[model samples]
Target chain A: MAIIDLNNVSKSYVSGFLMRKKKAVSNISFKVGNGEILGIIGANGAGKSTIIKMIQGFIRPDKGDILIDNNKPFDPASRIKMGYLPENPYFYTNLTAVELLRFSTSASGMPKQLADKRIKTLLETVDLYPHRKQRLKTYSKGMTQRAGICFALVHDPQVVVLDEPMSGLDPLGRKMVLDLILDLKAQGKTILFCSHILNDVERVCDRVAVMDKGHLRKVFTREDLGNQTMEEVFLHTIEERSEC
Target chain B: MLNKVLSLSILTFLEGVRDRAIFGIGLFALAMMSVTLVVLGFFMRELDKVAVDINLSAISLAGLLVTFFLSINLMAKDIDKRTIYCVMSKPFSRAQYVWGKYIGILFIISTAFAVLTFCSSLTIVIAKMQYTNWFKAFSWIEYFKAVYASFLMFVVLNAFIIFFSSITSSSFLTLLFSICTYIAGQTIEEVVIYLKSANGQEAQLSEFIQKMIDILQYILPNLSVFDLKVQASHAIHLPLDYLLAITGYAAIYSGILMIAASLMFSRRELP
Candidate 1:
C-alpha cells in the first residue's frame, strides 16, 4: 500500500510587485509505497524542493491532493508518523543537540525513558555524542547536518523525507548517511529522498524519478535501467527531452 | 494538542532566555534600578514618590525593550530564517505554532518582570528605611497593583507583536508596526478625551473625522488604563472593580489578537 501519495498535485507562486504567477509544479504526481526508497533528482528550480515542501504540508498546492498515511497533508495528525530534513537544515541555533532532540521527542509525545535512550543512540550513530551539549550555533555545517538527521529520526517516525541531505557532508559523513538510509529501508520505513548527487540516489533508491523544468520527465525502477548507468541514463533522458 | 504547544513554547522560551541581548537588557534594567537609589537623594521632598515612579518606569522600559527587541526577534526569526520548516515538519498546526510561540514569549517577559520586580522592590525598601518620613504616603498594596497592571500591559503588547509578525515576514517591519501601534495605543485614550471635551468641539471636527477617531478608539488598545504609576506613587488605592475591568479587557484583547494572528499565519505560504 502507498504510505505517501501525491495525485495530480499542482502549485504556483506569485512574486515581485507585479504579482506575476510562476508555476512551481504542474499536475505532478507520484507515490512511495511502504518501505520504498524513491529518489527525486533535478536541477535547481525544477520544483524538486517544491514537491517536498508540498508533501510535508509546509505549503499548499493550488490543485489536486496529497496524503500521508491516508490523511490530508494540512492536517497535523498526518505528520504524526512522519520525519523530514530540509535542504541546508536550519535549527534553533541557541539550543544544544540534546535539548533539540528532546524537544523533537517531546513534541512527538515520546515517553521520557524511551526518548532519552533513542536520543543517545541516534547521537552516537551520527558520531556527535561528544559535542551533544554544545549549542548548535557552535556547530559546523557538517555537524549541523548530522544533528538534523538525529532530530528527524528521534521520534522513530515511519515515513522520512530528506532534501539535499548530502549537501554539507564529507565523504565519511556521506557514507554514514547512506548507511543510515539503507538501514531505514531495512526497517520497512517509507522514504522520499531528494538529492542532486545521482550516484548516492542510484545506490539507495529502489526507483529514481527525474524532474525537468517543473515536470516529472521520467520515473524508472533499478531494473528498467538495464545496462545503462544512472549518469548516462539521466543525461540521455534530460538531453532527449530538451531536444524534443 | 496541549502537549505539542507546550513543547514548542518551552523551546521558544529557552531560545529567548539564552539570547545575549536578553542578558544585556537584564543588566541595563538592574543598573537603572541601582541608579534609582543615588537619584532618590536629589529629590529630598518627594523621595518615595520619585522612587516609586523611577522603579516602575524602569520595569516598563525594560518590558518595552524586550517586546520590541527580544520578543519580536524570537517570533519573526522562525519565519525569517526558515526555521519554521523544521518546526512545522512535526505534528503541529500553524495555529498551535503561533500560540506556542506567544506563550513562550510570555514566559520570557514574565521571568524578566519577576527579576526586575525583585530588584525594584529591594531598592524601594532601602529607600523607605532611609527616609521613613518621606514614605508616609507610600502603600505596598498600591505599588504591587501598579506592577501587576504594567505586566498586564506587556501581555497585551506582546499580542500586538505576534499579530504584526503574522502579517509580515520581515522582523524590521514587525518592529515598526509594533512601535506605531504602541504609540497610538498609548495616546488614543487622551486623543479621544480631548476630542470629546469643549476644546475639541471648538475645533469643529467634521463628522467623517469624528467617526474615524471613534473607530480608532475601539480598534486600538486603551493602554492608558494600564498606567497606574501616578496612583501608586500617590498611594491612591484603585477600586477592585476597576482592576477586574482592566484584567478582563486585557484577556479579551489578547485572546482576539491571538485568534487573528493564528488565522493569518495559517493562510500564509511558507516559501
Candidate 2:
C-alpha cells in the first residue's frame, strides 16, 4: 500500500516587490509504498525541499492532493506517525540533546519510561551519548546533525523523511547515518530520503527518483540501473532532458 | 491535544528562561529598584509614595522590555530561523502552535514578574522599616492590586505582540508594531479626554480629527484602565467590581487577539 501519496501537486512562490509568481513545482506526483525506501536526488532549486515541505504540511500545494496514512496532510493525525529532518536542522540552542529528545517524545505521546530508554539508545546510536547533556548551541555542525538524527528517531516513527541528512556529517558520521537508514529499513519503516549524494542514494534506496528544474524526470529502481552507476544515470537523464 | 500544547509550552518556557537577555533584564530591574532606595532619602515627605511608584514602575518597565525583546524573539524568530520546521512537524495544528507559544510567553512573563515582585516586596519592606512613619498609609492589599493590574497589562500587550508576529514576516516589524500599539493604547484615553475639555475645544480641532480620535478610543485598548499606581501609592481602596471588570476586559481582549492571530497564522505558508 502507498503510505504517502501526492497527486498532480503544483506550487508557485510569489517573490520580489512586483509579486511575480515563480513556479517551484509543476504537476508533480509520486508515492512511497509501505516499508519502501525512495530517494529523491536533484540540484538546488529543483523543488525537492518544496515537495518535502508539502508532504509535511508545512506548505500547502497550489494544486492537487497529498495524503499520509489516508489523511490529508493538513490534518495533525496525518503526522502522528511521521518523523522529519530538514536540510539543516536547527533546534532550540538552549536545550540539551536529552531535553530536545524528551520534548519530541512528549509531543509524540510516548510513555515516559519507554521514551527514556529510546532516547538513550538513539543518542548512543548517533555517538552523542557522551555529550547528551551539552546544550545544542555548544555543539559543532556535525554534532548538531547527529543530534537531529536522534531527535527525528526518538519516537520511533513509522515514516521518516530526511532532507540532506548527510550534509554536515564527516565520513564517519555519514557511515553511521547510512547504517541507521539501513536499520530503519530493516524495521520496515517507509523512508523518503532526499540527498545530493548519488553514491549513498544508489547504495540504500530501493528506487531513485531524479528531479530537475521542478519536474520528476525519471524514477528508476536498482534493477533499472543494472550495471550503470547512479552518477552516470543521473547525469545522462539531466543531459538527455536538456538536449531536448 | 492538551498534551501537545503543554509540551510545546514547556519547551518554549525552557528556551525563554535560558536566554541570556532575561538575565540582563532582571539585573536592570534590580538596579532600578536599588536606585529607588537611594533616591528615597531625597524625598522629605511622601517617601512611601515615591517608593511605591518607583517599585511599581520598575516592574512595569521590566515587563515592557521583556515583551519587546524576549517575547517577540520567542515567537517571531522561530520562522526567521526556520526552527519552526522541527516544531510544525509534530502532530499539532497551527492554532495549537499559537496557543502553546502564547502560554509559554505567559509563563516566562509570570516567572519574571514573580521574581521582580519578590525583589520589589523586599525593597518596600526595607523602605517601610527605615521610614515607618511615612508608611502609615501604605496598604499591602493596594500595592499587590497595582502589581496584578500591571501584569494584566502585559497579558494584553503580549497578545498584541503575538498578533503582530503572526502578520509580520520579520521580528523587527513585529517589535515596531507592538511598540506602536502599546504607545497608542496607553495614551489614547488621555488624548480623548483632552480633546473633550473646554480648553481643548477652544482650539477647535477639525471634525475629521475628532471622529478619528473617537474611533481610535474604541479600537485601541484602554490600557490606562489597568494603571493603579496612584491608588496604590495613596493606599486608596479599589472596588471589587472595578477589579473584576478589568480582569474580564483583559481576558476578552487577549482571547479575541489570540483567535485572530491563530486564524492568520494558519493561513500562512511556511516557506
List DockQ, one per candidate, in order: 0.88, 0.91
lDDT of 2 by residue, A1-244 (tens): 9999989999999999999999999888899999999999999999899999999999999999998999998888988899999999999999999999999999999999999999989988899999999999999999999988888888999999999999899999999999999999999999999999999999899999899999999999999997899999999999999999
How do the residues B1-271 of candidate 1 rate in per-residue lDDT, one tens digit apiece?
Answer: 8998999999999999999988898899989988988998787498888999999999999999999989998888778989988899999999999999999999999999999999999999998898999999899999999999999999999999999999999999999998988898899898787876674455577889888988778667978889999999999989999899889989999999999999999998888
Best by lDDT: 2
Worst 10 residues of 1 chain A by lDDT: A71-80
Colliding residue pairs in candidate 2: none
The regions of model 2 sitting more than 4 angstroms off are B200-218
Give the CA lDDT, 0 to 100, for residue A115 in model 1: 99
Q: How far is B18's C-alpha from truth in model 1 (Å)?
A: 0.8
Docking class of 2: high
Query: Across residues B152-245, which tens digit of lDDT does each residue of candidate 2 receive?
Result: 9999999998898888789999999888888988897887888767754554778898788777775679888899999999999999898998
Candidate 2, position B217, lDDT: 77
Q: For each model, chain A TM-score?
A: 0.99, 0.99
